[model samples]
Target: MMKKITIVASMSIVLLTTACKTKDLKMKEDRKEFISNKKEVVYQVFTRLFGNTNTTNKPWGTIEENGVGKFNDFTDLALKEIKDLGVTYIWYTGVPHHALIRDYSAIGISNDDPEVVKGRAGSPYAVKDYYNVNPDLAVDPANRLAEFEALIARTHQAGLKLIIDIVPNHIARKYEGMNNPNGVRDFGADDDVTVESKRDNNFYYIPNTQFEIPDTDAPLNGEKNPLVDGSFKEFPAKWTGNGSRRAKPDRNDWYETVKVNYGIRPDGSKDFPELPAHFDKKSAQEHFDFWKDKDVPDSWKKFRDIALYWTDKGVDGFRYDMAEMVPYEFWSYMNAAIKVKNPSAFLLAEVYNPDEYRNYIRLGKMDYLYDKVETYDKLKDVIRGHSLPDGLSDIQHRMVDIEHHMLHFLDNHDEQRLASPEFAGTPEKGKPLMVVSTTISTSPTMIYFGQEVGESAAENAGFGTHSRTSIFDYVGVPAHQRWMNNGKFDGGQLSESEKSLREFYKRLLNFSLNSTALMGAFQELQSVNRDSSWGYDPGIYAFCRWSTTEKLIVVTNFSWLTTSTFELKIPSSIIRKWNLVDGTYELTDQLYQESKLTLNVTHGEGRIHVVIAPSESFIYKL
Candidate 1:
């Protein structure tokens, strides 16, 4: 009986231990699955500049023309290329229809001008109708909805997300019915004005009462001459004829985009011209009310419906163009409404000014905004052969400042390319610098189209009224080989410099994707001593990213010359491993018998990489 009792006890103990081990293993597997699922890489594609099915002809027809031959299907062609790059998200730029009116007489046309007939008609930023998809981009006419659904389905199948562009600011300058030469019909303070003021025009004018700008030697309205008057002018008070003066034939007047008046007008008429037509506290609510329902002008209800239509079709997110120009409340409302349909949908805003962070993200609830400040300052400095100060302490501080809601990039469609000598100096020097900054920055990195290949910024690529041309030239090819044909300017035909940059980008991207430590939030390691070059060089930046389960240390050499004899002290509690990404390194035992890792960087070619090892960080364990 004693032997039997002991056997039973042992059996019970074994069973309990087995069950506990199984549970722990399952939990570990679950965590790994979660991390793997959350990994995402977004590839930006300028639709007009990307490859076209018809190589003989340009992708864009004319500004007024639609349904040009062999449209590039979003699902069939573009998404395939993105997936080939191992990217999980596709951010398609400027899919909406732009202005239709030809302003050649006013803006003056050049063959190389982006707005000219180089590719398609219309600027994607100048949205003509918010409620409709440009037919040119549509894959099927009768089953347009089906096509969009299929595209989303394909993206999901291929493990990718689709993000489209949304323009909430001023609509196309020549939006239909808005081009009426006569006074705006339904916009004034009247009950029976049935024309719907919101739909008739692309912009909602803000009345002058909300904010005030000092009147300096500001340019006069309608007059080419500069104002010499020293006296200040109440905004919207000095202007005449609804204050709507055509600044240029192609672009709308500045007053048209100014915020609406939120205060009560002195005349008691909401249509009082004396009030600066800015979207202020008072008029915004009314405009919101007017557009919330289908009854208001420009059909805000229809716009909402269009958004819903796309969301229902399964678009993952939207890249709102010129987001700063719109009201914060509008975005808040839109974001909430969109989230109701798709909770995980990403909302990215193209905000030029970083000062509007409070309005754009804090109050607005946006997911991400372009981090132009870091890209322009610290990143640019590194590429220009400037060493970071004190173990990149300054860079780390700046990174932390915008860490919560920042988007890092080496180049975007709006700026000059990093490959350009003017901006990046030279590809050989700039490529590695760009790679290091992108990898170590405290935000998810974004690679613009052709950036991997170090494509230089064309003359018309920057902010302009012209239609963007294909950054690469793709002409000739047989009829059957038309679709994504191996044309003259394929990805494989990159220049030597471009090829080097591309490989470097691929390495950085692969490193980020493979390592769990580099994808999420990280802590900057504080240096114990200030005398070391790693501690003082403004160019050498390093940071550690650690989750509860994983830890990673990323170090970057931003200078053109080799950095030698830099000492990095590791805590005795952590296990250290030395691996080289761009150069050679040796570990030495130093003070306190702790291992010291020394890295020898190559001249003009620096290293940027993440070191993943257990118990590596001083403060936290991953």
Candidate 2:
């Protein structure tokens, strides 16, 4: 009887040991997968604002300045500077050939105006040729590929990923060989009267339609329309004849950008009014359809080749500009092609809308989209003296809506800076605003150049380049000096408020990068009671993120002067003890064992950073 009992006991021990080994193996696999899925941070660079290699002849300076018309090489100095910023991805804006059309200037200016000529670096959105790199941005005339390769290599060596801008919607009006065959001229109204009148070009009349109405009612599609009334309705312009009148520059000139007609008919007989006269309507449709179907035209395939060319040279991804405007089918095909060439390649699309567009996530069109809704709405609330809402719930919904989709940024090239006095109350109030934006948001964040230094607006200037628009002050200085003086501008240096804001941002970024809680998925924690001040204010928000084995809590006080206090209900078995590393709060083991803890926070005192010690994050052992 004793021998039988011993045998049974031995069998049970062996079975338990085998189960333990299996669980360990599974955990290892899970860990590997989790690490692989970690998100990356991308920093955008306006190369022109970065520096000029030649001080005597600053290349790519305005044409009036007799600039050498080329960008500097990927200097080791520049790479080191960017590396110190603690970002994983570097997005180089406008690396391609600038628009060839020099005839018409942007709104609020004439073509011959000195400011117009000086500021005419050519809109990067208007692509002249996909194959050619802008000479101004190239380090060497002939070794463009080599220069690009070297840049990519250096970026990779510094533990950074490179993402170049890609404009897919429109090409330059005067591409060398691909000129507007339709005789459509930009400033043709001022040219020879007879010649301009005879041409049945689309550019002759700028549509003054309102966009308030749906696309179906708009005269020339909904693309070119003004906002009318409170709602977005489209009303035809007061112009008499089809090609008789020209609309004002800012209001309607952008309408001249023709829309592409995807082939819907089998015979391709549709006459797309947006097609340039030089292009055969049917042939253009066929061309567009070929690419849409993945049978890309050899000529058009150059765009894909450009992306692959850079990727093979070690670029990490492409920030596809105007991605939403392009046909969904094209991106679906493009993403597949990109993955085949480089699986690890990150594709970020500049999609502005929150609605699920045709190629959003289901088609695998892009890995990330510019999350405008979160930035403009949610982030706006916190800055406007409102409480930070239950962001975790919204984040959960967004995560479920688009799995593996990266959230883009609060500010980019097209928008004004959040730190600008226009948005964040004043320069004094900007620091707290910046903290909330960088830390509280769930998406992987992006930092525009000069943001870290808290560079505010210049006198009577907007946020980007023309006025306070510069990423850095690059006037009349050597490349090294300009590079070294990155965060400072010539006339507009960083203020005391700006310095503090910059340091705060740096710390927040480092903390986010280091914390698994901020980097990983978050779970919304339930409040103990709805009557509590924290729960009553829609702006006050709190959430907890936990790895399979570790847990973290994040709370934000969004009110201006109110103090918020709330109790946390944690599972006693999972959390043994937790400490707030921000060192503002004192939490004991009794609180954890009881599975309850009350948090008291002062409002508008900047984000009350609560950190847990002895962990990469403020962690509680489960």
Q: Give all candidates' CA lDDT scores.
A: 0.44, 0.44
CA error at residue 441 for candidate 2, angstroms: 6.9
lDDT of 1 by residue, 1-622 (tens): 1111111111132211111111100112222411332345667866544544343332222322212322234544556655655466788675554443233322222111222111224456655544444444444433433444565687777677878887655444234332222333322223222221232342333344222323222222122222223322332221111233222112233321222221212232332112123333222234334334433223233344556656876788988776775556555546656766676777788876766864676445576788776555556654553423233344345445444356666666666666666566555545444544454543556777666665554333212312222322222112212223454333444456555555555555655555554444443333432232232232344455544445554444444443323454332222231222444555331111243444444542222222312111111122
lDDT of 1: 0.44
Which consecutive 10 residues in model 1 have the weakest lDDT in total? 17-26
lDDT of 2 by residue, 268-355 (tens): 3322223233332122233344345443322224455557666666777888876775545456556656776676777888776667
Question: Which candidate has the highest TM-score of all?
Answer: 2
